[model samples]
Target: METKVAIVTGGNRGIGFEIVKGLCQKFDGVVYLTARNEERGQQAVKKLEELGLKPLFHILDVTCEKSIEDLAKHISTHHSGIDVLVNNAGILDFDKAISSYEDAKKLIDTNFTSLLTISRILYPLLTNTARIINISSDWGLLSNIRKQVWLDRLVKDDLTVEQILEFVNEFLNAAKMGKSAFFSIAGKYGDYKVSKVAMSALTFVQQRQFREEGKDISINCVHPGFVMTDMTKGMGDFTPERGAKAPLYLALEAPQSLKGSFIWHDCHHVNWDD
Candidate 1:
């Protein structure tokens, strides 16, 4: 039998690291720990090794197209395809004013655009039974999108990726003009929230497309909860291990019937209000 493989991006530390540790303990095959920095990736692997868990390290900078392509090629050549993928790599800058166009653009690029690119690049290498879990946040709940028109578009069953991209660009354009004040969620940490919303929107789009293609793959977005991590500046309530449980459950335990669902950390399905 071929060796199964799971890849977790941003696995060098925090929740990503905990996810890797859990997979190493549960997954029946190789668990890869990927990070943008090689040195940190190696260090993370070393720490896992201390626990007698072996995790492969790969350099992955989600924002870089070449890096994503390289990882995909490697997976294709060495493992045939990936059985599991956790898009845990994302960024948030609390210091940047939410209204700053530059800051918001950067957040969108890293949190949404890069994940989209990486997913597309590695999609070809996904096996029929592959499970793809997108790490999103509760802050991205559809309720945050107060504009009726925008909310309608997002919840539309037939929403297209092109349309979603257009919506994101439109928001960015509005932000550039310093006129995003009308946005209901454009307050402190608004960029982070907006980016997560976009990510969730993309999740729905991808799930629909996959179903339309008649693929057997399972795709889902999840909120890992407000965990105590570097991103939260260690001010969160849950530990990294506790935060990893939700994603781990989705990756290893969720049934095929649960595909395309938006799950909360507690493993409950979120109802997107119409």
Candidate 2:
């Protein structure tokens, strides 16, 4: 039998770190804790090792194609294929120092576009029955899209990845133009919300495509809850460990039937259209 392998991005700290720890304890496979900074990534791995948990370190800047491809090549050479992937790298820049458009562009690029790029690039390396867990947010809920037309498009059972991309691009263009209307469409935390919403929609589209192609892969997006992390400015109700629970469940133990769903931190399936 081939050795099982799991990859967790942004694993240097917070929820990503906890997910790595959990997988190290429970997953009967090699768990890679990837981060953009080599030093921090190695440090995190060493810390886990001190706790008597084994986790490998790799440098992965999700926004960089070369970085992603290099990691993909490494995985292909070292393992038969990937068994689980957790897309946990993201940013939340509410800093008033930057312009709103700049912030929006950065958020979309890191949180949404990078995900699409990495998934497309590494998709061929996924083994049958592989699990993909995208770390989304409560803001990803379809209800956050106040515009009925946008909601209708996203909720379509036959929604395509192209459509999701178009939706994201439209928001980007609007943000570029400083369109307050588009910002209102997603309400507070507009850029972050739209990016996550796109992620959740993409999850459904990917799962549907997998089914149509007769692949055994499972994909789901999750809201890790408002965890107290640097991204949240340390003002959330849950801790990073609690935030990792749902994502860990989906990656290692959730039923395949749970594919394409948006899940809460408690592991309950959330109605994406609701």
Candidate 3:
């Protein structure tokens, strides 16, 4: 039998770190904890090692194509294929000190676009029954998209990834042009919310594509809830450990029928269109 391998991007800290720890303890395979910074990734692995839970570390800067390719190449060379992938690397609007347009671009690229790029790059390396869990947010729900037309387009069962990409590009263009109307449509944390909305939508798109391609891979997006992390400025209803529960469940335990769904931190299925 081939060795099962799992990877968690942005796994050096916060909920990502907690998920890595959980996988190290429960997953029946090698768990890799990936992060953008080599030092931080190694440090996180050491922390888990001290806890007597072994998790391998790798450098993964989600926004960088070269970095993602390197990780993909490493995985292809060392393992049979990826059994599980947790797309958890992301950023909040306040995490950077750039202009609004630049900030919005970076946020959208990191939180949303990187998911597409990394998945596409790693798609060939996924095992037949692989599971992909995208870390989305409640803000990603279509309800956050106050515009009905936008909601209608995204809620379509036959929604294509191209449509989702176009929607994201439209939002970025609006942000660049200072269109307050677009901001009003997305409401608070506009850029972040839009990016996650795109991520959740992409989940459905990928699942449909996999099904059409005759692959057994299952993909789902999750709203990990407002966990107390640097992203939330440490103000939230749950801790990192609590936040890790649902994602960990999906990664290691959820039934394959759970694909293309938006899940809550408690593992409840949520209607993404609502």
Candidate 4:
């Protein structure tokens, strides 16, 4: 039998760490916990080891294509391919008063663009029944925009990946020109929200591509609820373990028939049209 393997990016802490632990306990194969920092990543693995759960460690910086490519080559060489992938890596710059174009680019690149890059690289290595979960936020909902015109464009089923990239680029460019508030819906956390919206859009596009290619892969995105993490300054109603539940479900138990859907943390289908 072939060795089954799973990879969880940004798994050194918080929800990602919990997801790695869940996979280590439940998955019948090896689980790799990836972090950008080697010391932190190895420490996370050591903590899991204390629990008798063996999770390997890898250094991954989603913002760098070289880092993503290196991890892909390592996995392909060692495990033949990947059975599960949880794209838990993401960022949220909470400085509402800071609106630098460079920061905006970083936010979108880490949260949205880099995901597409990694997915593109690792997709070919996915097995027949593989599952891919993209961790998203409810803030990406169409309702957040408040403008019917922009909301319609985003929720439209026919929206293409190229169009989504164009949309994000437009926002970033506008921000660079000192018009960060140019969009009606972006408000303060414009960069973070726009990045997640693009991620949601990418989920739909990839799902359609997979179907067109006749693959049995399951790909979905979910809002992991507002959890207590460093990103939230440790202020949230839910724990990190609770936040991991939704992504873990989408990665493992979700039916193949449930592809391309945006799911709430409670595991219900979200009405993107609303």
Cα lDDT listed for each candidate:
0.85, 0.89, 0.89, 0.85
lDDT of 3: 0.89
Q: Which regions of candidate 2 fall more than 4 Å away from where they truly are? A: 95-99
Q: In candidate 1, residue 273 scores what lDDT?
A: 49
Q: Alpha carbon lDDT of residue 214, candidate 2?
A: 96
Distance (Å) between predicted and true CA of 148, model 3? 2.1
lDDT by residue (tens digit), candidate 3, 116-179: 7887899889999999999998988888886677888998888888899888887777777665
Whole-model alpha-carbon lDDT for candidate 2? 0.89
Indicate the worst ten consecutive residues by lDDT in candidate 1: 179-188
| Ten residues in sequence with the least summed lDDT for candidate 3 | 93-102
Candidate 2 to truth, TM: 0.96
Query: In candidate 3, which residue ranges exceed 4 Å CA deviation?
Result: 94-99
Give a tens-digit lDDT track for model 1, residues 6-83. Answer: 999999999899999999999999999999999999999999999999999989998899999989888888897899
Ranking the candidates on lDDT from highest down gives 2, 3, 4, 1
